[model samples]
Target: MSIKNTIKNWVLCSALLAALPITVTAGNKAEIGVVKDFKVTSQLASRDQAVRMFEGEFFRDPYIYLGPDDYYYLTGTRRHHLSGGSKKDWTSEGVELWRSKDLSSWELLAVPRRLGDLSWVDGLKAHSDEVGKGNARVWAPEIHFINDKWVIVHTTSVRKAMLYVADKAEGPYVETELSTTIDHKHDPSFFHDDDGKVYLTHRVDTVVEMTPDFNELTDNEFKVKPANRKMGHEGLYLTKVNDRYVIFGTAWSTDKIGRGSYNMYYATATDIRGPYSDRRYMGRFLGHGTPFQDREGQWWTTAFQNGKTMDFNTITKAKGLEKKKYTVFKDGIYLVPLELTVKSDGDVFFTPLDSRLVQPGPEEVQKF
Candidate 1:
């Protein structure tokens, strides 16, 4: 099957599966199930000079966290302007890293080299007879500190996924082979559990246990059965709350145009490799959704709005099975708080606290 057809089928499967009903339970303890409605207030930060410093034409997938330097670092894909606006001009777009003390202000730290820049592509080219032509697109780059080393995982159209390591958070990274068969993988995320097990999660609802070396999977990769399988995409992050693995991700319409209007959802399981239950809608129509925990241990989600205005939404957990939810909407990167409510049949709904939030102006670039 062609990549286009495969994507179309995946989208169709997701939509069909989403119509099914899900049930919510509180860990292994509570039997009481109640449906609650919650709200979020859009904490729009002023896009003064400080905020605009992080603004750029190609900034998406804002993965923010404090680095070993005791400062926050944000990294994502960056695009280049080629002479002609042709598709071929979109070469191996590299990952860009930015640093900031506060979440609001950011500074460019490094532009890491691409996987094609490394020797791995030579191994891939060796298989070109079987896999056909190779094209690499650096996507959804994430930085994590593991075993006294800063590691990066990003997706590629050619090789699927690759792991790169560096001494520092902002990297001059070197690529190491992880998986070449997990093709079409995007939005790669890493989660280090309390039990000292590290896992990687990404698009298409797949998760795999990683070896301690963080270079390869120890077991066969498995799909995460979230309530609505079709609705999940983009970055996924895991945190253990109340002794349960809480997996959070954003679900958007498979249709590119329909994504901006979709909401975010999360699910929880007692086991990290889960028959994960209690799927709940966390928030709605938030784009490229990712979460970060503050120094106070409060969790917040950063999401962007679709269409004109391109505002940001910062939200927190408000009410429901989860303690509190919050969110905000502004241009560039935004954050929001989310609250999960359950229905009698186990369907979940995410209610945005502020509805009238403005998005950025329509992008002038032409779509492929």
Candidate 2:
């Protein structure tokens, strides 16, 4: 194709997208737009500034886990999936995974678990077309390497969660009996403690011990609430740092006030189930992002276009933000550099190293 014709095609495509609604709704709920192309007109951020990644895929609550084989595995909310953007996210047929040696380039590994893989999901689907059309949907899918096998955890639009076990990282994942135990679950996460205990979290704070085989949720279920406040609305995650337990959750910048910038907040505790300290800011517009480490041991947290993503300059400027587009890329995932700091008091906290991402915005309801 000639350069002139290629440019013409780009212009035509942009106009078509602009003519469409921001969200293609089904039933009565809105679903996040899926990715058909990862390419952008310009790089949202420089390589040195932030490790921004692109692919022909749409993702949310982005998760990347370092597997036992030493490869990084990634997954996310693929709600509408490949149904040409008509179906809703929760009704996604199943889970999709990708792998990479380095964060920049990724290869699609497999759609290991389709909606039909587990017969139980059918039992949960609403009798009516509550979700427009399609089976129960999956959200916030997570992959973990635990007990010498692969375990996948995800929540559904039906307000339940699932646990699947597979022999390989990418696999013909099978349903586990534990799925029946996790009811009213949302944004579930996995954690393997230093002493070898396996834990799963849901509803932003509630936790349950899991058997070593990842098949059963033991009788011990409890909540790990923060001392200062509830950890926002959804997208709860877990990790450990320096013998302390750190939990992260997503919420709007205006607290209970909705429709503001989606952001991340975290709290630390000495014990697994804790009376955690007050929540502190992780970064602006990083809601539901997964904090991870590259092969070089540098820390990074995932970020994506959720309503309005802020550039480094705009995220800190905090004036008339509502009027600003506050973003460039409308799809794909991002890696924001993070500094993990330990205070003299033995508390571990996170700070975004990207200058535009470091500070909380003016819309933040909490003082911290």
Candidate 3:
């Protein structure tokens, strides 16, 4: 059968399966909703089935919240293993961005052109010899709302870390200069603490802090200690729960080379600045990551499970303080449920509730 027919059959089979309904409470109020449950089936599922339906390719580090618009924008390095060689030969497809109305259904926006796209090969080569070596390609693009505007933090092999600003999420994003400390910076994550302080986190020895405007760093800007002395090149999530700051990161140990082996881990700090302890493991054998809590209070961790599948694990509570794990069983984008427990002293623990797999409507699927 043609791929189209197979997809039609898959969709039909999926819809025919009954979904279990669950009640979701918002904050301290009573709210309820129904969701489907499914699991990834075949490796050969069409791109639409694997990604548009399953939200596979959209799994990148530093999933950032873009205001109360009920959307999270994520960006990551554009990889092209099929066209091997100097990274320069790998064209700047720029960065890929996705929009999720709910954490379950995602829409592909435009792949913004990188700074190098403004010129030709020779011109780009003149900009920096590193471009010739293919090390200057764009990597790890992150977006955040600051000073009433959306700002993007990204890296290029040539200049390392660069900043861009746009009035809208989708844009002809313009580049801006923030800092030039681009020695080993990749995974650029921006976070706004509860006290109105903005900080940038990335891999290099430890998560570093940048000036509020992201233009410069204070004397103690890079003084913050590392979360894990062993793990590097991972996502960073800063969330306030129960009035305390929580930090999440992953440790990579994949031997497959290129295929990263990362496991989800976290730590908590009384203050955003320093003195964080009580490190613990959340998800095992997960890599290239991001951990987030949805509006419905469902918590999820997105990671690459080797090169075969990108796993979205749902955290379920079996009892007090302990959590269970469920994979995105079928092939499609799913909003796994998450539960947040607030302590009287303001400490919060975000636990994964359950899995509610969602498939893209026929009209919503993108045509190649």
Candidate whose lDDT is highest: 2
Q: Candidate 1's residue-wise lDDT over 1-368, tens digit each? A: 00001464344433322121111112311211221111111132322111222343434466766655667666665333211223323422456566655554455566555544566556655443243243345656778887677888776543366677888765667665564444555567787766677777776466788887766777667776554444354556666654556666654433342323444556766676676765555554455666555443434555653333423432222222112111233335555543334555554333444443222112201111
Ranking by TM-score: 2, 1, 3
Which 10 successive residues of model 2 have the least lDDT summed? 1-10
In order of appearance, the predictions have TM-scores of 0.66, 0.79, 0.61
State the C-alpha lDDT per candidate: 0.50, 0.66, 0.44
Q: Relative to the unseen true structure, what is the C-alpha lDDT of residue 261 in candidate 1, on a scale of 0 to 100?
A: 40
Residue range with the least summed lDDT across 10 consecutive positions in model 3: 1-10
After superposition, candidate 1 runs with Cα above 4 Å error: 1-6, 9-53, 81-92, 123-134, 179-184, 227-235, 253-260, 305-331, 337-368
- The deviation in Å at residue 346 for candidate 1 is 18
Name the lDDT value of residue 22 in candidate 3. Answer: 15
Q: What value does the lDDT take at residue 227 in candidate 3?
A: 50
TM-score of 1: 0.66
